[model samples]
Target: MRSLLLLILVAAIIGGIFFAIPYFRAHPLGQSTNPGATPTINTTATALPATGIGTIKAPDGESIGISDGTVAFATGGPGGSAKMQAADKLKAGDTVSAQSLWHSALTSDSGDAESLIYLEDQHVLNAHVTSNTPYVTIVVATMMTGDNASVGNDNLQGAYVAQKEFNNSSQLAGGTLVRLLVANSGNDKLYADTVAQQIVLLAKADPTFVGVMGWPFSSRAEVAINTLAKAHIPMVSQTASDDALTGASPYFFRVAPANKRQAVLGAKYAEQSLHAKTAVAFVDPSDPYSQSLERYFAQQFTADGNKILATEQYTVGQKGHAALPQLLQNAESKKPDIIYFSGYAADIGVLLSNLPTSGQFATLPILGGDALYELNYPSSARAGFKHLHFTAFAYPDEWDVQNLQSQKPKF
Candidate 1:
């Protein structure tokens, strides 16, 4: 009887070991069984390069890399993939299909501001291309990601509206059609010069390619402008406002007021409207736009008998972010009457969001140049600063009114 019981126990133990081995193999340790759970990835492994993954053949039989095309430097996420797909469709002469893919990509990326206008322009332009109709291409190059994305979107929309009207007008008299090509210059316009080189290639390959427009950021615009100017391409800036860009190139022209004027206006507003006597200015040293605004603002403020307490410097990336607390602490220590940030909206948004509600900084009015006009902080974040003000290129309603009037020209 003892031997029988021992045999049964041994058999049961062996069976349990077999069952557990298969279970462990199927569901390894430290792995989640939940379907929605994300699997752990080895981030330290050799990762793929963000740009320059694939190549597309241009009209001139030249292979264009991913870094210098429709979605320049935006070659990582779903938006980038979709844009690449659209490029493939465009190359196949299927602009109608490409338009759909572009729309999808834009929607997925929450980039819907220029959607309708972009689609309309693409349809019209692609029709001309497919029919072998004579058309002139104007490339709109700007920062299409990060804080400047809104500005870039506005630029694209404005260009499309102009293109549509020009193409439909009797003034053209059935002349060469105008097509706008969007070239994204990365998050902070880091790839603007590379994109400019690509535009030069396009101009060389296609005789119909005429000009370039929309360099909204100064630092990047300076480099890009030099490249395009050397290539003898006529270029126009929609909203770049740095004084240094005044004679950046013979080919470059801008309709917007320079930073000197904008800073003077900003200084006057701070003194007269905000009742600020002394100020501290925050600037991004790497960005010429920020530097220009800071220099001009300081000069104007001091000229108006107001003192500048200090000027704080910060760049854009990880180092800047890591030092933000210390920078804010230093700025707070200055105890100035007003705080002026002459940086782009992204950094300012971070500064504003992190600013403490109850402190020496509390109830202090913050002023900035037009670069902060696109500050898109959430309502909760915005509520923290009741006196936040920035100079704008123009009022929002005026843009709508002008657009309407342009569409319905009298006489």
Candidate 2:
């Protein structure tokens, strides 16, 4: 009787642990600060003054409104000002100072409400306004483009729309915005390097450019990040996913999650959830992004006791590679449970068209890296790729909207 009771107790404890694990993983108890979203503002603006600082604390629900030293700040609920209460009494050359949080002057009507008062590196506004239409510059290389039928149009179009919305909205730190200068990289790796170098030089010659927005492919981004680093220009990358690019330089930051991070997660999923017995890796011999991730995935999957049936290489952009037949035959021989491809969507599409319709791979699960997410996947071909899953490290539109909803006014 005691033995049976002990067994029951052990079973109950194991069941409790299994149920609790999911909840703990799903919801973290606390949130950390997003340094990028949070702005630090110190109102103390002086060229060279004794003590070099002055601190001012406004009343609760009131912001330290500083413009040309004439105080005409709106006092209301945290970040509820309908329009800026302009202090026209102050003019250029006059100095204004305050200490408070820097709220999103762009999308948020909560003017400087949630911004923390970090006193370091405070500055006086340039006070020089531009009457000319503001132009936003986008930088990229042709390696970022899509192929026929699914020609990467969706991604490029989405980026263009997002940029237009950002510039036209009331959130602009400067004045009215206008044209978008898209600098193209001619699909050549060498050209990508040159394009990046020219962008920085051009920005220095023109002062109107506020910030840049692209470098779609990770290879192009690898080259561009270094040039933009020296320029000290703020840029937001739309699609670059190389893990090394994160915090690569002071000026480098990505709108998309690092690619390797997503790959690691996929690796874990394959091991723990899918219980994959064997994995076959197919990588583009020419493409750096595909090759790097393929190598990394193979190392990880092998470490997990999952047998790597084979590591095959295919040259990118070359039509009708002889490797497909070998790949199918290998799949039949090894019967790998999982097949991972780190190559362009077009290449994968072609390979899928030629893959053997019988046996092992007919039912084998297919996995891929970020290159698969290119918008060019043919709609008709979507069903053919029923077994395909691609990894992308990015916050979908829903996550951004949730962030907006949860935002609190710092005032």
Candidate 3:
């Protein structure tokens, strides 16, 4: 009897520590905790190569100041090169004067090649002798919806910034530079196919476009790969962490990790780390991402000798809290140790808000996939669900991490 009492006391203490800590009170989605507040400035401007004489016009017809030893040409969209052409077929060590090569790009339909910077203006550069030109174009394509899809935009922006810096540097290829072409699918549901078709068309117009950057959603990637495969174009994605995409096509690749890996990691934490044995699940029956996670969690939990006490599903945008009362009553009778929610943030927030006052979930752990990582879940509502836990992939923004670690909160 005395030993039983001590075990009970210890359990209470452990539970108390889990809830009472201030860190526990802080929501992961809350304002960034970055330490450094100010951004450092890079004030150095790109220095153009010194040229004896002649003017430099960018692909867009914008004249950049000329310098000795520097070569210039057009950049950006297809429209930028209209009417204007390279003055000559200059090569790597060629010393051809600017006037010699001016308007030299359009000698034939096949000869409308990408421009390059020359060393001597003497011979056509060997590097530009691509069975096609030595240039590659990348396109970022994504669906207009889902957190998973939006993640690609972040990576795309970062890549563009890096590309700009690279092009301006002295380390550019053969004294030439790189260029980028950016397009938005405009949140079009058909954008997956439309944007992909556009990319292929762009490549047809200029075979030098050797690579692509993205398709934010898995479905979009699936659709785009059909064309990308035949074209031999390799792609990298920031989102679409779907396993079905990898190795599915020789040309398909993604830099961002997939959701399957995330779900497995989250499930391990929910089952082993949180010690949840009996769980009740609320899934969104219509969404593939939610359904996939639910199925995996169910299989994993059952494998661990734990049973799902109950499962209740609603459509993607169905009224969630309205069904919660009856579900909670049923779940209480089964005494689940956890409630695993598999839905997007907007819907899950409603379900979480409506959990009944009486039952195991009133105080038990509430676990979820990436759905709970949203910033919109009310802090107070989350406070009510003290035992909530979820998985998040990347560390928050760099500056945010620094501020939070320093405890100098950014408003």
Identify the leading candidate in terms of TM-score.
Answer: 1
For model 3, the stretches where C-alpha displacement exceeds 4 angstroms are 1-136, 144-157, 164-182, 186-190, 206-208, 284-287, 317-335, 352-364, 370-388, 396-411
lDDT of each: 0.62, 0.47, 0.48
User: Can you give the lDDT of residue 106 in candidate 3?
Assistant: 26
Ranking by lDDT: 1, 3, 2
How many angstroms is residue 69 displaced in model 3 relative to the true structure, after the best TM-score fit? 31
**Residue pairs in clash, model 1:** none
Q: Which model, 1 or 2, shows the larger lDDT?
A: 1
What candidate 1 gets wrong by more than 4 Å, as runs, is 1-84, 102-118, 125-133, 168-175, 188-190, 378-380, 397-411
Per-residue alpha-carbon lDDT of candidate 1 for residues 193-255, written as tens digits (9 for 90 to 100): 556656655655555555666576777788777666656666666567889888767667766
